[model samples]
Target: MSDINRVAVIGCGTIGMSWASLFLAHGLEVQAYDPAPGREAPLRDFIAVATTSIGRPVPADTTALRWCMELEDAVGNVEFVQENGPDAEDAKRTLLAAIDRLTPAHSVIATSTSSQIRSAITADCRHPERHIVAHPFNPPHLVPLVEILGGADWAVERSTALYRRLGRHPIVMRREMRGHIANRLTSALWREALFILQEGGASVADIDDAVRYGPGLRWAIMGPYLTYHLAGGPGGIRHFLDHLLPGHVKRWAELGTPVLDADLEAKIVQGVLEALGDRSIADCMRARDAMLVALASLSSAADDAQDDLRGDA
Candidate 1:
């Protein structure tokens, strides 16, 4: 429901391209900029492929996409900007400052930073209030969760409405954090996975299988808190705290901190390569996207059924 339709996408990396595809699929005009040469071909290819996986009505022609060579040209008249610059502090600071200066006063600038906080990235900008962090999960075109934080109340409200209109589930954080929310949780799990590998407790394939076939399946529907609350049965979270908290604490205390040394890195690389066997990176990505589309369809149907039941109640 955002009145703003023209959007600017700075940077043409994996994240930037994905954002462009999603924005265009939602019927927004996208002006994209990247310093790298000969990027148009790949960018168009990515958009075409992403549009299919998006499972949404996309523009018939790539005419809605305008490739700009200069930063100012891309954001000059756009109503909204989605920055996908490098994660480095200096690079983001410089890029954001430029965007703030070039874009209109009312335009909201959202960065796709996965780790850095918005405040730090916008510390050098003249209008920090106009900027925010809108970190999307990997393959932004496919993922529905976008973690939003920072910006003034108006900017946050506008960004939230815009993302929702685009069929994205946006979580607006009350406070800024280093890794936002999802990344922090994912990092904790990744650290444990690394430890398990280094300690020879499980193979890479086994860890992936345990997650994909186990808790990961449920996580697709409900988060950890809701899942654990159900585990408590009739008594809810109170029973969980009383009966299971001790074991959880014990496991946490025994969690190992494994460094990514050369040996461990080699093991991880070989394990992943062996797991892939004959599949290339593109092949794996295609497979992953196909499964994501199917899962999203199921989740949508379940949500609709729940809504119908609630109406009946």
Candidate 2:
């Protein structure tokens, strides 16, 4: 039913491993090629952990998955290429150029880049039109939000269709911008959070708790706009705009503009380290991914409100 029966994951990092595992779970032939040596074992190990967490068992000797030493061998015949190369603009352009040269012309090349836009990365590629940013929220096997952007309509549509089949919620950015949509929103929140920390409004852990216990509960179901709309009761967002918007505007004017100096950076680093205390990175990732899987299971395709006259739900 799907045209994407085979996929080539062009990196063996956390993002690539997760993408490969998700593709493999959906019964696609996966040829994974990474520049690093002795990565096959770790990749397979991560996949095992990921699948077991999802309650899906991967076969020991399945020919559906292959490890290739050469990038050419990996991308030569695949229908899709998921590039999770280093986030540097130059490195990404070089890698994508190589993938574009090796992969079939009909194949779609999607970058898992968070910081770089498609135009910058695909600049060196011969067929730039086939490329798109399919940025996933960390640990792609569980977290299903994929921010996709591309020049070609066909490529974007196909990528969207493929992601939908993978049980991912793909949002196509109408225009190109660095950091895409989700990361931009995340950056705005992070900036405010850092400002709060700089001003000593709360301890690092308490700030996290405030979010996790308060607005996060509502955010788990709907975003800030929807929450505000509901806040307006019978009149919706229009009522909120007329009544409560002033308070928010005043608060926004008072929001701190934090500069990340050495001291501020250290404070954040040390604060996070203290908050993390006994938890290992592995422990944190495992737990976070498990929680994400559960949350995603409970999630529906909540409305974006773009078409909302009354409100699209």
Candidate 3:
């Protein structure tokens, strides 16, 4: 991450714009580009709101941002490139190949594709070793997680360091895989939740609440693995794995495999609309950002209290 101050955001959609905003807030020079005309204003608007949402001071000067209409111009001298193209396989391969040709050999190229695997994305790249996946959660300006997969060790270290510099938690994968880490875990939960909804076992809002109020709150403290380790009490994980683990196998076997056919799709649409009630998308987004900030504060305070207790001990 040394001597790397300029980053090219190669697509001005939500993820690209949010990346540009976070970079700008961290005082990095951002060269933003999109094929569509008249995206500069929207990107600026998004950056302004996003910066506020994350409690970062709005970019005092927009001079640090360079809006580009051409791909080659954006990546010419950038130290890193974040491509946010549509999630099609051939399109991403073509776009990455073009960026690879234009960008300097030293710059790391990362895709913001949520599910596309590395082999497909880097198929046409002249230097696939530096090409990697850097998927950020939606509303990435607020979410601190960035999932990294598929890169040479050097490129991976640089990218991971860059994310840390921006105060993001980046998880590097030991193996290349589709859907990466977070998405795969969540998708399994979603499959069963949808199956339950379709079967009239739970309302959409109720299912959401089950996670949001229950496992989600616990997950924020420690993930499922550690939480279950505690469930074994004095015996800890060794005892749980040896004794209690078999009980979960039957539950896993009973999980549903749901298909989102037309009727189920319509049910989901109606249920979600009802759940949303009177809240607009903007309203929900604002509330979500606010809660994320509050949760971060809570975690920080909990860490401080734990440190104090350790000192007493």
Residue lDDT tens for model 1, 1-313: 6887899999999999999999999889999999889887888888888987887646546578999989999999988999998998889999999999999898999999887867788988889998989999988888899999868999988999999888889999988778989999999999999999999999998998899999998999999999989999999999999998899999999898898799999999999998889999989999999988888788889999999999999
lDDT of 2 by residue, 1-313 (tens): 3588999999999899999899888888899999999989998888877877766757857888899999999999988899998999999989999999998898999999888867878888889999988999888888888999885898998899999998888998888777888888888888999999999998788889898999989988888899999999999999999999999999999887798899999999899999999999989987888888778756642342444535635
Colliding pairs, model 3: none
Better of 2 and 3 by TM-score: 3
Question: Which regions of candidate 2 deviate over 4 angstroms?
Answer: 300-313
Error of 2 at 20 (Å): 0.5
Candidate 2: residue pairs that collide: none
For model 1, the run of ten residues with the poorest summed lDDT: 54-63
* TM-score, one value per model: 0.97, 0.93, 0.94
Worst 10 residues of 2 by lDDT: 300-309
Worst 10 residues of 3 by lDDT: 53-62
Using lDDT as the measure, the top candidate is: 1
Tell me the lDDT of model 2 at 254: 88
